[model samples]
Target: MLSEESSTSKENIGLTSSETSTKPRSNLMASVELTGFADNGAGTISATLGNKANKDIAKTVITQERTTDGVWTCKIDGSQAAKYKEKFNPTGCVKK
Candidate 1:
Protein backbone atom coordinates (compact mmCIF):
# COMPACT_ATOMS: atom_id res chain seq x y z
CA MET A 1 0.00 0.00 0.00
CA LEU A 2 1.32 3.40 -0.97
CA SER A 3 1.48 5.99 1.75
CA GLU A 4 -0.38 9.26 1.32
CA GLU A 5 2.84 11.14 0.71
CA SER A 6 4.01 8.67 -1.93
CA SER A 7 0.66 8.70 -3.71
CA THR A 8 0.45 12.47 -3.68
CA SER A 9 4.01 12.78 -4.93
CA LYS A 10 3.31 10.46 -7.83
CA GLU A 11 0.16 12.40 -8.73
CA ASN A 12 2.02 15.69 -8.62
CA ILE A 13 4.84 14.38 -10.79
CA GLY A 14 2.55 12.42 -13.14
CA LEU A 15 5.13 9.89 -14.28
CA THR A 16 5.67 6.17 -13.86
CA SER A 17 8.39 3.77 -14.99
CA SER A 18 5.99 1.92 -17.27
CA GLU A 19 5.00 5.04 -19.22
CA THR A 20 8.21 5.21 -21.26
CA SER A 21 6.78 5.18 -24.76
CA THR A 22 7.18 8.50 -26.57
CA LYS A 23 6.51 9.78 -30.05
CA PRO A 24 8.50 12.44 -31.81
CA ARG A 25 6.80 15.70 -32.61
CA SER A 26 6.68 17.24 -36.08
CA ASN A 27 8.35 20.47 -34.97
CA LEU A 28 11.62 19.10 -33.58
CA MET A 29 14.65 19.42 -35.89
CA ALA A 30 17.59 17.98 -33.92
CA SER A 31 18.01 14.23 -33.56
CA VAL A 32 20.10 13.07 -30.59
CA GLU A 33 20.14 9.91 -28.53
CA LEU A 34 19.65 9.02 -24.82
CA THR A 35 22.35 6.33 -25.21
CA GLY A 36 20.88 3.61 -23.01
CA PHE A 37 17.33 4.66 -22.11
CA ALA A 38 14.42 4.15 -24.45
CA ASP A 39 15.13 6.17 -27.57
CA ASN A 40 11.57 7.42 -27.95
CA GLY A 41 10.53 8.22 -24.41
CA ALA A 42 10.00 11.96 -24.25
CA GLY A 43 8.48 13.03 -20.98
CA THR A 44 9.17 13.78 -17.31
CA ILE A 45 12.45 12.37 -15.93
CA SER A 46 12.78 12.76 -12.17
CA ALA A 47 16.25 12.73 -10.63
CA THR A 48 18.04 13.91 -7.52
CA LEU A 49 20.19 16.95 -8.25
CA GLY A 50 22.68 18.15 -5.65
CA ASN A 51 25.04 21.03 -5.00
CA LYS A 52 28.81 20.87 -4.63
CA ALA A 53 29.32 22.55 -1.24
CA ASN A 54 26.28 20.96 0.26
CA LYS A 55 24.56 18.07 -1.44
CA ASP A 56 21.41 18.52 0.63
CA ILE A 57 21.30 22.27 0.05
CA ALA A 58 19.90 21.86 -3.46
CA LYS A 59 19.01 18.23 -3.23
CA THR A 60 15.63 17.73 -4.81
CA VAL A 61 13.86 15.64 -7.37
CA ILE A 62 14.76 17.53 -10.51
CA THR A 63 12.51 16.67 -13.40
CA GLN A 64 13.76 16.92 -16.98
CA GLU A 65 11.68 16.49 -20.11
CA ARG A 66 13.05 14.37 -22.91
CA THR A 67 11.87 16.23 -25.94
CA THR A 68 10.91 14.63 -29.23
CA ASP A 69 14.39 15.35 -30.55
CA GLY A 70 15.87 13.18 -27.77
CA VAL A 71 17.33 16.01 -25.70
CA TRP A 72 16.73 16.22 -22.01
CA THR A 73 15.37 19.67 -21.25
CA CYS A 74 15.09 21.02 -17.74
CA LYS A 75 11.72 21.92 -16.27
CA ILE A 76 11.94 24.30 -13.28
CA ASP A 77 9.84 23.44 -10.30
CA GLY A 78 8.94 26.19 -7.80
CA SER A 79 12.13 27.92 -6.51
CA GLN A 80 14.17 24.73 -6.37
CA ALA A 81 16.82 25.85 -8.86
CA ALA A 82 16.58 22.53 -10.67
CA LYS A 83 17.39 24.18 -13.97
CA TYR A 84 20.48 26.08 -12.80
CA LYS A 85 22.20 23.04 -11.33
CA GLU A 86 25.51 21.95 -12.86
CA LYS A 87 24.58 18.51 -14.25
CA PHE A 88 21.43 19.79 -15.93
CA ASN A 89 22.92 23.11 -17.04
CA PRO A 90 24.77 23.59 -20.37
CA THR A 91 24.23 19.97 -21.52
CA GLY A 92 21.03 18.80 -19.78
CA CYS A 93 20.33 15.43 -18.12
CA VAL A 94 22.52 12.43 -18.98
CA LYS A 95 21.19 9.03 -17.97
CA LYS A 96 24.17 7.97 -15.78
Candidate 2:
Protein backbone atom coordinates (compact mmCIF):
# COMPACT_ATOMS: atom_id res chain seq x y z
CA MET A 1 0.00 0.00 0.00
CA LEU A 2 1.15 3.55 -0.69
CA SER A 3 1.08 6.38 1.82
CA GLU A 4 -1.60 8.95 1.38
CA GLU A 5 0.71 11.66 2.72
CA SER A 6 4.35 11.18 1.87
CA SER A 7 7.31 13.55 2.24
CA THR A 8 7.60 15.65 -0.90
CA SER A 9 10.42 17.45 -2.66
CA LYS A 10 10.79 20.27 -5.14
CA GLU A 11 11.26 17.72 -7.90
CA ASN A 12 7.86 16.22 -7.21
CA ILE A 13 5.33 17.15 -9.79
CA GLY A 14 2.79 18.84 -7.50
CA LEU A 15 5.30 20.50 -5.20
CA THR A 16 6.18 24.14 -5.51
CA SER A 17 9.57 25.87 -5.50
CA SER A 18 9.47 26.52 -1.76
CA GLU A 19 9.84 22.80 -1.16
CA THR A 20 13.36 21.39 -1.16
CA SER A 21 13.28 17.93 0.40
CA THR A 22 13.85 15.01 -1.98
CA LYS A 23 12.46 11.54 -2.30
CA PRO A 24 10.96 9.54 -5.14
CA ARG A 25 7.24 9.12 -4.68
CA SER A 26 4.79 6.96 -6.59
CA ASN A 27 2.30 9.19 -8.39
CA LEU A 28 0.36 6.28 -9.81
CA MET A 29 -0.58 2.82 -8.62
CA ALA A 30 1.43 -0.32 -9.24
CA SER A 31 2.08 -1.13 -12.88
CA VAL A 32 2.36 -4.49 -14.58
CA GLU A 33 5.72 -3.36 -15.90
CA LEU A 34 8.65 -1.54 -14.33
CA THR A 35 7.40 1.76 -15.76
CA GLY A 36 4.89 2.28 -12.89
CA PHE A 37 1.79 2.30 -15.05
CA ALA A 38 -0.92 -0.11 -16.21
CA ASP A 39 -3.02 -0.24 -19.34
CA ASN A 40 -5.92 -2.62 -18.65
CA GLY A 41 -5.32 -4.58 -15.53
CA ALA A 42 -6.97 -5.27 -12.23
CA GLY A 43 -5.82 -4.14 -8.77
CA THR A 44 -4.78 -0.65 -9.82
CA ILE A 45 -6.08 2.39 -8.00
CA SER A 46 -5.00 5.80 -6.73
CA ALA A 47 -6.67 7.90 -4.08
CA THR A 48 -6.11 11.53 -3.22
CA LEU A 49 -7.35 13.71 -0.39
CA GLY A 50 -7.55 17.19 -1.84
CA ASN A 51 -7.13 20.40 0.16
CA LYS A 52 -6.46 20.89 3.86
CA ALA A 53 -9.79 22.34 4.89
CA ASN A 54 -12.41 20.25 3.12
CA LYS A 55 -12.19 16.50 3.31
CA ASP A 56 -12.71 16.04 -0.40
CA ILE A 57 -11.31 12.73 -1.51
CA ALA A 58 -11.06 11.19 -4.95
CA LYS A 59 -10.38 7.54 -5.66
CA THR A 60 -9.46 7.05 -9.30
CA VAL A 61 -8.98 3.85 -11.25
CA ILE A 62 -5.75 4.43 -13.11
CA THR A 63 -5.65 3.47 -16.77
CA GLN A 64 -2.39 3.89 -18.65
CA GLU A 65 -1.09 2.69 -21.99
CA ARG A 66 1.90 3.19 -24.23
CA THR A 67 1.64 4.29 -27.81
CA THR A 68 3.12 2.32 -30.70
CA ASP A 69 6.11 4.67 -30.48
CA GLY A 70 6.47 3.80 -26.77
CA VAL A 71 5.16 7.04 -25.27
CA TRP A 72 3.20 6.83 -22.06
CA THR A 73 -0.46 7.86 -22.12
CA CYS A 74 -3.33 7.83 -19.65
CA LYS A 75 -7.02 8.31 -19.22
CA ILE A 76 -8.92 10.47 -16.77
CA ASP A 77 -12.66 10.81 -16.48
CA GLY A 78 -13.96 11.88 -19.86
CA SER A 79 -15.96 14.90 -18.75
CA GLN A 80 -13.30 16.12 -16.38
CA ALA A 81 -10.64 15.57 -19.02
CA ALA A 82 -12.55 17.69 -21.52
CA LYS A 83 -12.92 20.58 -19.12
CA TYR A 84 -9.43 20.46 -17.64
CA LYS A 85 -7.48 19.28 -20.71
CA GLU A 86 -5.58 22.56 -21.19
CA LYS A 87 -4.29 22.51 -17.66
CA PHE A 88 -4.22 18.77 -16.88
CA ASN A 89 -3.00 17.59 -20.27
CA PRO A 90 -5.21 14.51 -20.24
CA THR A 91 -3.62 13.24 -23.42
CA GLY A 92 -4.74 9.98 -24.99
CA CYS A 93 -7.69 9.93 -22.62
CA VAL A 94 -10.74 9.30 -24.71
CA LYS A 95 -14.40 9.37 -23.73
CA LYS A 96 -15.61 5.95 -22.75
Candidate 3:
Protein backbone atom coordinates (compact mmCIF):
# COMPACT_ATOMS: atom_id res chain seq x y z
CA MET A 1 0.00 0.00 0.00
CA LEU A 2 2.85 2.44 0.78
CA SER A 3 4.56 1.83 -2.58
CA GLU A 4 1.30 2.35 -4.47
CA GLU A 5 0.61 5.65 -2.65
CA SER A 6 4.09 6.96 -3.43
CA SER A 7 3.75 6.05 -7.10
CA THR A 8 0.38 7.84 -7.30
CA SER A 9 1.79 10.94 -5.61
CA LYS A 10 4.62 11.09 -8.13
CA GLU A 11 2.20 10.78 -11.03
CA ASN A 12 0.00 13.55 -9.61
CA ILE A 13 2.99 15.84 -9.25
CA GLY A 14 3.94 15.28 -12.86
CA LEU A 15 0.39 16.06 -14.01
CA THR A 16 0.35 19.27 -11.99
CA SER A 17 3.63 20.47 -13.48
CA SER A 18 2.42 19.92 -17.05
CA GLU A 19 -0.84 21.84 -16.41
CA THR A 20 1.01 24.99 -15.25
CA SER A 21 2.44 27.29 -17.88
CA THR A 22 3.40 30.85 -17.02
CA LYS A 23 5.30 33.41 -19.06
CA PRO A 24 7.97 35.72 -17.73
CA ARG A 25 7.66 39.47 -18.15
CA SER A 26 10.06 40.77 -20.78
CA ASN A 27 11.82 44.14 -20.88
CA LEU A 28 9.99 46.52 -23.18
CA MET A 29 11.57 49.40 -25.11
CA ALA A 30 9.81 52.76 -25.31
CA SER A 31 10.65 56.38 -26.10
CA VAL A 32 9.63 59.93 -25.21
CA GLU A 33 9.78 62.81 -27.74
CA LEU A 34 9.79 66.45 -26.76
CA THR A 35 10.57 69.69 -28.53
CA GLY A 36 10.01 73.47 -28.57
CA PHE A 37 8.01 73.27 -31.78
CA ALA A 38 4.46 72.01 -32.29
CA ASP A 39 1.47 72.65 -34.50
CA ASN A 40 3.54 74.42 -37.20
CA GLY A 41 5.49 76.31 -34.54
CA ALA A 42 2.30 77.57 -32.96
CA GLY A 43 3.05 75.89 -29.61
CA THR A 44 5.81 74.42 -27.45
CA ILE A 45 6.06 70.70 -26.84
CA SER A 46 6.80 69.22 -23.36
CA ALA A 47 5.67 65.64 -23.81
CA THR A 48 6.72 62.56 -21.87
CA LEU A 49 6.26 58.80 -21.81
CA GLY A 50 5.33 58.91 -18.08
CA ASN A 51 6.13 56.25 -15.46
CA LYS A 52 8.01 53.71 -17.46
CA ALA A 53 9.81 50.63 -16.13
CA ASN A 54 13.11 52.54 -16.35
CA LYS A 55 14.14 56.12 -17.12
CA ASP A 56 17.11 55.08 -19.25
CA ILE A 57 14.85 52.97 -21.46
CA ALA A 58 12.85 56.04 -22.46
CA LYS A 59 14.68 58.12 -25.07
CA THR A 60 14.18 61.54 -26.60
CA VAL A 61 15.22 62.33 -30.17
CA ILE A 62 14.30 65.88 -31.03
CA THR A 63 15.43 67.49 -34.28
CA GLN A 64 14.56 71.14 -34.00
CA GLU A 65 16.58 74.37 -33.84
CA ARG A 66 15.34 77.65 -32.39
CA THR A 67 16.54 80.89 -33.93
CA THR A 68 17.14 84.26 -32.31
CA ASP A 69 13.92 85.50 -33.90
CA GLY A 70 11.82 83.04 -31.80
CA VAL A 71 11.35 80.81 -34.79
CA TRP A 72 11.64 77.04 -34.73
CA THR A 73 13.58 75.45 -37.55
CA CYS A 74 13.85 71.70 -38.07
CA LYS A 75 16.12 69.56 -40.22
CA ILE A 76 16.21 65.92 -41.17
CA ASP A 77 19.30 64.14 -42.51
CA GLY A 78 20.81 67.59 -43.18
CA SER A 79 18.10 68.60 -45.65
CA GLN A 80 15.35 71.22 -45.72
CA ALA A 81 11.74 70.04 -45.23
CA ALA A 82 8.88 71.23 -47.36
CA LYS A 83 6.24 69.12 -45.58
CA TYR A 84 7.85 67.11 -42.87
CA LYS A 85 6.01 63.97 -41.71
CA GLU A 86 8.24 61.99 -39.41
CA LYS A 87 7.91 60.47 -35.94
CA PHE A 88 9.58 63.39 -34.19
CA ASN A 89 7.84 66.59 -33.22
CA PRO A 90 7.95 69.92 -35.17
CA THR A 91 7.89 67.92 -38.40
CA GLY A 92 11.09 69.46 -39.80
CA CYS A 93 10.84 73.14 -40.86
CA VAL A 94 7.44 73.36 -42.60
CA LYS A 95 8.79 75.68 -45.32
CA LYS A 96 5.29 76.24 -46.67
* TM-score (all chains, Cα) for each model: 0.29, 0.26, 0.21
TM-score of decoy 2? 0.26
lDDT-based ranking, best first? 1, 2, 3
lDDT of 1 at 75: 44
- In the range 12-94, model 2's lDDT, one tens digit per residue, is 24322223322223333212112232343322222222223122212222345555456655644424221233244345555
Q: Residues 1-96, candidate 1, lDDT per residue (tens digit)?
A: 111233422332222222232221211211111222334545554544342324332434445576767776664332444334444343543322
Off by over 4 Å in 1: 1-40, 49-59, 76-96
lDDT of 1: 0.36
* lDDT against the true structure, each candidate: 0.36, 0.32, 0.31
Query: Once model 3 is optimally superposed onto the true structure by TM-score, how far is the C-alpha of residue 72 displaced, in angstroms?
Result: 0.4
Order the candidates by TM-score, highest first — what do you get? Answer: 1, 2, 3
Runs in model 2 deviating more than 4 A are 1-57, 77-92
Window of ten residues with lowest summed lDDT in model 1: 24-33
Q: Which of the numbered candidates is closest to the native, going by highest lDDT?
A: 1
Write model 3 residue lDDT over 36-94, tens digit each, in one string: 23234342322222134344323322234655467865543312223323443353443
